[model samples]
Target: MQPEIQLSNSTTQLESTQNKVLRNTYMMLGLTMIPTVIGAYMGLNINFAFMAQHPILSLLGMLAVMFGMFMGIAANRNNALGVVLLLGVTFLLGLMLGPILQAALHFNNGAQLIGMAAGGTGAIFLTLSTIATVTKKDFSFLGKFLMVGLVMLILASLANAFFQVPVASLAISAIAIMLFAGYLLYDVSQIVHGGETNYVMATLAIYLDIYNIFVNLLNLLMALSGDRD
Candidate 1:
């Protein structure tokens, strides 16, 4: 009976901890949208002549942004500044997505396709997140696999970007959607199971997953739906 009582208490504490982590992750994830939108607007409206002239600049910019993201994660345990920096990093990512948006906007059905992609991606994310919470299964093992897949995908994308391979582009978009969907599930499960305690880090991971899904979905939709007139 004493052992049973202690087991019940431990279960209750775990549940309480899970609740806090989930709530904080969701709240921080919602807050990240504000800066993302602001950065997108800035990207769409603002033009950088230097960036236009030097494609390498974009590559270097990506490297710098990734460095900042790693730093933010490393600092998340000690300070609130990590949260602020994470938001700023997301804003930078939004800016990077500007050119893609610019290209999509040129299509006759661009706006409609973008809206559909956004809705579809959101629905998938919600479904995956719900599954993670309901099942409470640990998906942390996906981390290494996801990293390897992403690296391969990035290399393929860079090659296709220069080579202009239509099939490659389609493959990347499809793989990206699936990969990020898995990521959504894994990240949410971490929060629900008390594996991820820091809201800032949780938000950053989930935000990147969602953002990649949207980008890939939008690209896929554009390739399929966009009419070249």
Candidate 2:
């Protein structure tokens, strides 16, 4: 009886910790959007002609900066600095969106398509997160598969950067949407199942998932439904 009681208490405590982490992650995730929006707005006014002329170099430089920031955030995950670094990363990512946003805004219904993409991404995230939280299903099994898919996706994207194949670009965008949706589920499930104990890290993972989903979804919409002026 004593052992059983102790085990029950431990389980309850674990669940409570997980709940707190999830709540904090949601709050931090919300806060991240403020900086992201600000950065994106600023990006719209900035010139990116250098990137246009050196696409591959620009891609490599962006990736290097992002990777370094990710490492910094992870290293400081237990402290307030992690939160700050995460926001910085998001801001940088938002700035990176300038090129795509510029392209979209060239179309007559660009703003409309952007709204729809945001709505779709929100719907997908909410649905997957709800399913994960309510069902309490372990999605750790997806870790390896998702990693494999991500590598493949990266390879394809790099190839297309050189090939400049329009259809392949569309395909990559479509695949990215689906892949990131799966990541949303897996990330939320990690929090629910206590697989991710740090709220900052969890928020970062989920945030990235949502960001990728929105970017890809917007790309798809722009490709398929954008109206030219």
Candidate 3:
């Protein structure tokens, strides 16, 4: 009976910690959007002609910057600096959306499509996160599968960058939407299952999932339903 009581108490404490992490992750996730919106607005007004002129160099540079920031965030995950770095990376990502957002806004119903994409992304996140939290199922099994799919997707995207095939681009976006949705489930489940104990890191993972989903979903929507003016 003593051992049983001890195990029960430990389980309760673990659950409490998990719940706190999940709650903090969600709160920080919400806070991240403010900087993202500001960055996007700035991006809209800025000129990216240099990027258009030197596409490959621009892509590589952006990737390098993002990778560096990711490392910084990970290294600082145990402190407030981690949260700051996370927000900084998110703002950079938002600024990087300039080209796509500009393209989407070129269509006759661009604003409407953007709204739909945002709404859909929000809905997907809410549903998947709710399922993960409520079910309390360990989705760690998805880790490997998602990583494989992501690698394949990246390879395909890089290949398409050279080929410049519109259909292939659309296909990549579609696949990306599914892949990141899975990531959202896996990420949120990790928080719920105590697999991710740090709210900063957990928020970063979930934020990236949501960000990718929105970007890909918006790409698909702009491709499929955009009415050029």
Candidate 4:
């Protein structure tokens, strides 16, 4: 009887912790979109011709900044400072979207494609998150496989950056869409199953998943159906 009672109490505590983490993560995630939208809007108005001309340098610079912010956020994950750093990183990511957004907006149906991509990303996130929450399955098992895929995807992306092959770009975009969709499930499951106790860190992981999914989805859509002026 004593052992059973202890087990029940342990389960209850874990559930409570998971609930709190999920709630805070969601609130922070919602807050993050505000800064992202503002930055993206600003990015749209800015001229990124230099980045367009010097793609590799631009990519390296963005990666370096993102790495720095990631380190900052990781170092501060226990306090509100993490939240601030996460928002800063998101804003910078939004600004980095300028070149791609500018390119997309040049197409006749660019706005529609962007909207579709956003809708698709939302749908995927909603479905995966719902599944993870409702089923409460342990998705931590996915971590290793997903990391391997991510590393490979990064290598392919870097290679294609210099090769500038249209087919390789399309393939990379397709693979990225699949990989980050997997991340959506893995990330949300981590939150629900007590694998991730810090909501701030959880929000950052999930945000990256959604961000990558949206960007790659938009790229694929544009490649498939972009209308030229």
Candidate 5:
């Protein structure tokens, strides 16, 4: 009986910690969007592709973005500087997203499609996040497999850009949504299990997961719903 009581108390404490981390993570995630929007607006207005014209420059730009992402994740363990850098990185991401946004806006129903995509993305995030919290399932086992799959997805996308394979694009988008939704579950469960304590880092992981999911979903939706006329 005494051991059972102790076990119950420990469970309660863990739950309390999980709730706190989840709350803080969400608060920070919400805050990070301000800079992202500002960056997107600036990038759009300036027509900043960071890789628009020169192929070599575009490759270099991608490398730089990857470096920034690595630094943001690694630095997150130590200081608030990580949080600042994460926002900066996200702003750059928004800039990168601008091209897609621009393309989406070109369609007659583009604005409506964007709204629909955003709504769909929000629904998936909320549903998956709630499931992760309620079930307390550990999805970390998916990390390595998903990473490998993402690499393949990237390679396939580059190949398709050259080959212009419509089927390949559909396949990539489907895989991306699945992978990132899994990523969302893993990220949230980390907070729930106290595997992640820093709100900035937590927010970064979840935000990236959410962003990828939304972008891929939007791509799929646009392909299907876009009116080329």
Candidate 6:
């Protein structure tokens, strides 16, 4: 009886610790958006002509920088520095949004499209996360598929950068939305199911999922519904 009681207490403590980590992750995720929004607002004013003139080079450069940050975050994942690096990454990504966001605003109903994309992304994030929670299924299974889709996404995006095909661009954006939606499920499920124990890393994963969803959803809406004026 005494051993059983101790085992139960140990299980309860482990659960309590996990809940604390989850809560901290959510808090950090919320904090990250402030810097991201600020960076995006600043990005809106900057000239993106350089990107247009040097599209391929710019894309590769951005990828390199992103990879560096990923490594930095991974190295520091268990520390406060990881949170700092993650926020820095989000800010840089927000700045990168300048080009697309600027393009969206050129359309007649651009503002509406942006709002719709944001709303849709939010809806997906919430719905998928809720499902993961209620079902409590281990979504680590999705990691391999998501990684493959990510590789394909990068290749397609790089190709479209040069080819500039409208149909292909739209298709890529659509695929991206689905891929990141899968990531959202996989990420949130990881947090709930103990596959990921680090809140900092969890927040980073979920944030990227939402970011890609918003960007691609906005692109798709612009393609399908934009009033060219």
Best by lDDT: 2
lDDT of 4 by residue, 18-103 (tens): 99999999999999998888889999999888887988898899899899899999899998899899999889888877767888
Please, what is the whole-model Cα lDDT of each candidate in the order they appear? 0.83, 0.92, 0.91, 0.91, 0.81, 0.89
**Per-model C-alpha RMSD:** 1.9, 0.7, 0.9, 1.0, 2.4, 1.5
- Deviation in angstroms for 59 in model 1? 2.1
Expressed as tens digits, the lDDT of each residue in 63-155 for candidate 6 is 899999989998999988898899999999989889888999999998899899989998998899888878878788989999999999999
lDDT of 2 by residue, 1-229 (tens): 9999999999999999999999999999999999889888888999999999988889999999999999999999998899889999999988888888888899999999889988998899889999999998998899999999999999999899888999999999999988988899899999999899999999999999999999988998999999995
What is candidate 5's local distance difference test score?
0.81
Which stretches of candidate 2 lie above 4 Å from their native place? none
lDDT of 3 at 28: 95
> Candidate 3: where are CA atoms >4 Å away?
none
TM-scores of the candidates in the order shown: 0.91, 0.98, 0.98, 0.97, 0.87, 0.94
**Count: clashes, candidate 3:** 0
Task: Give residue 208's lDDT in candidate 6 (0 to 100).
Answer: 91
Any residue pairs clashing in model 2, and if so which? none
Candidate number with greatest TM-score: 2
- The regions of model 4 sitting more than 4 angstroms off are none
The model with the greater TM-score, 1 or 5, is: 1
Worst 10 residues of 6 by lDDT: 14-23
TM-score of 6: 0.94
Off by over 4 Å in 1: 48-57
Where does candidate 5 clash, by residue pair? none
User: For model 1, how does the per-residue alpha-carbon lDDT over 4-121 read when each residue is reduced to its tens digit?
Assistant: 9999999999899888878988888888888888888788876756666765656667787788676766677458778778878888887877877877888988778878988998
lDDT of 3 by residue, 1-229 (tens): 9999999999999999999999999999999998899888889988999998877779889989999999999899998898889999889988988888888899999889889999999999999999999987888899999999999998998788778899999999999999999999999999898889999989889989988989999999988899985
Ranked by TM-score, top first: 2, 3, 4, 6, 1, 5
* TM-score-superior candidate, 3 or 4: 3
